[model samples]
Target: MSNDNAAPSSSSAAANGSADSAAPRRNSKRPKYSKFTQQELPACKPILTPGWVISAFLLVSVIFVPIGVASLFASRDVVEVVDRYETACIPAQNRTNKVAYIQSSANKICVRTLTVPKRMKAPIYIYYELDNFYQNHRRYVKSRNDMQLRSNSSQDDTSNCKPEDLINGTAIVPCGLIAWSLFNDTYSFSRGNESLNVNKKDISWKSDRDHKFGDNVFPKNFQSGGLKGGGSLNESKPRAGGSHCVDENCSSTNFQKVVWEDRGGSQQR
Candidate 1:
């Protein structure tokens, strides 16, 4: 009862529909070879074969191996000196109770003499290396008023500098645990008999002088004899209303320092 002509027509229509569903389209991800595109641009494609790679590596090695060896030999001439001073400085009997001895108003001076084997170069650095010391303690660090230290107007600003902040009623200018616990220990260098002249001009950063602290700011009531913290500040000079020489030392002698060394190998206490 099916017509052969109708069957052929249905089959042709199905084929036509399937073809129309998806017209021929190029892949989006695959690069097109257009004249303006880089894929079709004229370029030198240097093929790095195994032989080429090996040759390049060999050439680099040949140039660098001699240079590296020479550099190693030159570096051998440089030497670093690390002299242990704690054991040599502290007394034998007081070793048991070092805290008591150090805290007490007792003379704690020790000297060491060293004979140099080789000539030390110029621009040599001398620095302190403390053992069993915590410089980044929470309580020690946060006890500072940046506002008080920076400007003369903010001299009364002692919110952060507690305990050591105010003496009686007056606020300490450089009020903080860090400033209070400055380096009491001093280091000086001498060669033969002539004492070496120290250049402390570059001890602090230029930015600290220019930005961090104002020229008008000066020391107020640093140590009021309650408890002498560490190093003494030059608070004798009176501020004369302007950017005169402010008597305040902000060098990190213990915590951070890289001082110019004297022409000697000995480290004295």
Candidate 2:
């Protein structure tokens, strides 16, 4: 009886092993269906209707109306004096050929008398404005190397400012149309022959002078190209404070100019 049972058990084991081996295996690399892949999961989606759109507009108005009114009220105390001197500053004889006038080394200064209705309080600001110049154009926008500005080590990394990027393979610091065409205008504030002390110290953005631009970085081959733009930079000094005041496009009071650098695009004002 024991012999018969052992033989039957061995035969059953062999049959089971043979059956398992003979079954076809599933491919491990095969993709399987998933609810996520098929996008069958439930979600909350907002539909925009006429009522919903109107509600959104009302909500924005409710939140921003007070802020706008408050801003106007606050700025009312501040006084701004703007002088568009591009045309007035230029010598009448050279108005037609402003490009040549700017390129020349001749003195570019004009005194324009300004009448301020309200007295400019302390911390009087000065500004210059531009018209008909597209500083945001694609070519002008991409013609800068921020890496070079941020770090002294990356001065050679001027791949963006092509054409103005280099001079005989030497990279330009602050290379770009923005930097080349820097706002080189100089202003002297005076009220009836009394020179007001224009406090220029710490006027620029603290974050930019300290962080955005590297302290070790200075100008190199700037305005050295065939066609020079607005300004020239000091070679020995670092760019921290040596650079021209260009944090903004256009500010201060009723003032007269002693000297103004004629710098801008062909169509600039």
Candidate 3:
């Protein structure tokens, strides 16, 4: 009877213990938020509304607006400067009207008078482009041919002077007269004391009291025996110094000296 009672008591104790063990553990992941310490929980904030979103958009605009505007103006300034030097002072000529139109595109570039700002770091580039313009200016065959003839005569040391008089008063003409002449011979251009040499010589020579053109003219005695073997040409060396002066008869003439003065001017004193 005692053993039966002991077995029943033991079964009751085991049943109570099983019920306690089945209860949910406090540290399990299912409801872990409840176990979080006060310091471990994230702080809560109010939900964003339409007003907050609008305010944020205005804040971004205030920061970037001035930056964009400044950049636009800077770009425009760069474009203006480049355009100034790109166009021609004279517009391109066309078939209808063969004359070129004068247009002021850039300040004329000159070496001595380099008046324009040399902001360009690459001088070789500037020189190349300038040369191209000059070549195009000379390509008009008919116009250039006529202009060349005129240019040569315009600065002719013999111009406006009678053959009888070696020294004449100072004559002033265009600067292109000297520039073109030297360019033909040397393929370069320059302006300096040499540019005004013609006037300087003439002015100094005029101070002589006695001046005659015939004294400066070439003598007719030295004509190169009118070509050989029936050729109507005169192969003689023209004028003494080989200047490009020819008589109305097409006879070659030479210069005694570059100075324009009568042959006997120094002896007159």
Candidate 4:
């Protein structure tokens, strides 16, 4: 029984070894990912910096601000400088010297001009002063003096001052026409007030020679010397026409001379 058992065990071991050797060796396969080409990111582009923009703006301001300021100041100075010859120039140009001093204060502007002379006095035409409402607070003053007149004429005697160009016996040389035009233009620019009609040519002056051009207006309560018209100086009780303060003889008063008034609240030129 032992021999039988031993023989069978040896035969089983031999069979198992044969079975193990007969089986084929198999290798395991691994899972694989898809094959694709990788894409590269694009390089960043250069952008404008905030600091550069700010620096450019600052540079422009530095260059232009001073020039703008200088130009403004230069124009102001030029206007003030030209205001010195109000009275002297009018008489020198054979034109009458006109003065307009408004009453009281409201809407008041002191206007004066240098009248351009007649044909005999050509080339000596002095443009009347054309000041309007103040542009700035900077005042300009010119005092009364004969020296400011620019004329080589020995007939410098301003005794019987001629009225501004007016309707002569036959000729209609409008009085204060040029001066009125200038005053209107300048006043409009300075004040921008449309109602202040300083340049209206339609309005008539009651008196030509005796009538003064102050504001180119007649005082409401004022009476005119009757000469022809009822409320006119020409038809006053007696003929009060000729010129301001001149007697019926039309004698030369020598007071007809124009003198510059105060400027900047002080006398100058």
Most TM-score-accurate candidate = 1
Q: Estimate, for each residue in 42-95, the C-alpha lDDT of model 4 and write its tens digit.
A: 658667699988988999999999999999987654422134544543444333
Residue 68 lDDT (model 1): 100
lDDT of 3 by residue, 1-269 (tens): 99999998999999999999998877755544542643566668877899998998899989998889999987654421222222343334432332222122243342332343434333121111122323223322112121212233433343322221122343221112211111100112334544421211122233221222222222221112221111111224221212223343322112212121123111110
Instruction: Summarize candidate 2's per-residue lDDT along 62-147 as a digit string, tens digits.
Output: 99999999999989988876677788888889899998888898987778888887876765556566677677688887887877
Model 1's number of clashes is: 0
TM-score of each: 0.62, 0.61, 0.18, 0.18
Distance from true location, Cα of 86 in model 3, Å: 29
| C-alpha lDDT values of all predictions | 0.63, 0.67, 0.31, 0.31
Candidates 1 and 2 compared by TM-score, better number? 1
Model 1 lDDT per residue over 1-269, tens place: 46978998999999999998878876699676787776566879999999999999999999999999999999987766777877678899988988777778888877777566678887566655656655577887788777765678988998878778888788886687766765566767777897866544344444555556555566778867568776655544322222233325333321111111111112222
Candidate 2 or 3, higher lDDT? 2
Best by lDDT: 2
Q: Name the runs in model 1 displaced over 4 angstroms.
A: 1-74, 77-79, 237-269
Q: Give the Cα error of residue 31 in candidate 1, in Å.
A: 23
Cα lDDT of candidate 1 equals 0.63
If ranked by lDDT, best first, what sequence of candidates would result? 2, 1, 3, 4
